[model samples]
Target: MTGSASRPRAVLIAGPTASGKSALALSLAERAGGVVINADSMQVYADLRVLTARPTVEEEARAPHRLYGHVDGAADYSVAHWLEDARRVLAEAGGEGRLPILIGGTGLYFKALTQGLSPMPAIPPEVRERVRALDLDAPALHARLASVDPETAARLRPSDTQRLMRALEVFEATGRPLARWQAERTEPPVLPAEEAVRIFLATDRTALRTRIATRFHVMMEEGAMEEARALLARNLPADRTVLKAHGMPWFARHLAGGITLDEAIEGAILDTRHYAKRQDTWFRHQLKGWSAMTVEEAAGLLATMA
Candidate 1:
């Protein structure tokens, strides 16, 4: 039998932010006896619910929700961590005869679920700290990485500090290129795509941009500043994933009196728009065979899946 045939079928709902994927997932979960699980990386952190646009308590109460706010903001929550949690959740849902609805805009998470992920060795704290202590600019780090692991360095943009640092850390930890480890991957995919109904919410570019702007505005009005303030006060380590959240830098500046609230909002909206655009592009190219539809259409299709 194929991989999917041995497991209960799951539904994967993916889309750019503000595309109404969460609402659609909730409606479908309520109707289809499915549990709505978070696939978005940001939503896993408890620190930025409003800014991350995580499902509200009322929405979550409407359906079974899993993995939302299960992680602390200061934690180094990696894809491996998420994949492990997700596999457990999937098994639990299967055991209960409940459909599993995985929904999020994080393309990497969905990809890992369907297409298996290569194992990355854990970088030692000393090596990680050494890299972080350099505080090198992206270009300088990229140059440094190029000297040690040119193949990985070539693949990353000079401005991609996180990825550059990751590559450098891997090299420092293992004396091997990150690409080499990736090529050695043998782990099996957790969710076979053929066994799941994949839905991609496609919105018009203009509409998505407008929605992005509106959502940020709402976030500001809905205690997003307070959330940012609280998180900043915790003084978490720099490499924590929560600090890389969209609007974080701008919010920090606003909190520090380095920028006006209006400027921070504008910056956050622009960043979100760029991120949404990247998400749209990624789903279009990386996710094959998914049924791309509007949110309304997706809600209608859920009954068929159920």
Candidate 2:
């Protein structure tokens, strides 16, 4: 990783959903004359703004924001795409002499910004279709991957269907395991850790759960269901990542009459809470050398940086 001798060029605020990341970023940007650059995967979609809990229009107007709701929902935006966009935004911030504050719950995005991502060989369309056509659940796919690329399979959860399939596809296309490619990182990190003030908000689990549930209710009040309906109306592919935005599938099921609205709300809340838990775990295990603190503590620390 590269190091910078000057003061920190950027601030990174990462945490679980409903952990006050957006609010804190906005406040810090306002104080520091910074640009708020999004690192959240879901919030990048223009289709599910409400469900993804993007900043309000008024809040966005308070500070310069970049990379929020910029991609079409039909597009399968990936970490590589986000990284490319972020590089440009970071460069612009540097040229304009503004502090760049990147805030989100997506651990992979943060990791990509700090430690460079590995470049995987592209899977041919035929290989991808074959993998997608296989009649197998996540566990079955994982078992299959274990037969071919046990090293990569051992690292992935059996329940992580998306990543499991990706690993399997890589194995099928290339003769090597996914792990081999990951061991050789060709893409350099955009913001090396030494150049940024990196923080992970460590909210109490109970408090975070309560906040997530409460915020889900607030999203409902803000027409998250309607947002889901509009996105659904576009009839995008079910595999599209945007369709899996928190509360989106539940709302779709509710709209389709397969579940009651109340049930959908409860399901979405449970899913979001579980996702928050996963976010916390990923940061703890995957990200290194980041200060872990409560939101209040983070605010104070970032205030000095601002």
Counted clashes in each candidate structure: 0, 0
**Model 1 root-mean-square deviation:** 6.1
TM-score of 2: 0.82
TM of each candidate vs. truth: 0.82, 0.82
Flag regions of model 2 displaced more than 4 Å: 1-7, 119-185
Model 2, residue 298: what's the lDDT? Answer: 84
lDDT of 1 by residue, 74-170 (tens): 7766666889999999999989988899999887778878877645755534356557878789899999988878888889999999999998887
C-alpha lDDT of all candidate models, in order = 0.83, 0.83
Residue-level lDDT of model 2, residues 226-263, one tens digit each, is 89899999999876768877788788888999999999
Model 1 spans > 4 angstroms off: 1-8, 119-180
Best by lDDT: 2
Each candidate: RMSD to true structure? 6.1, 6.4
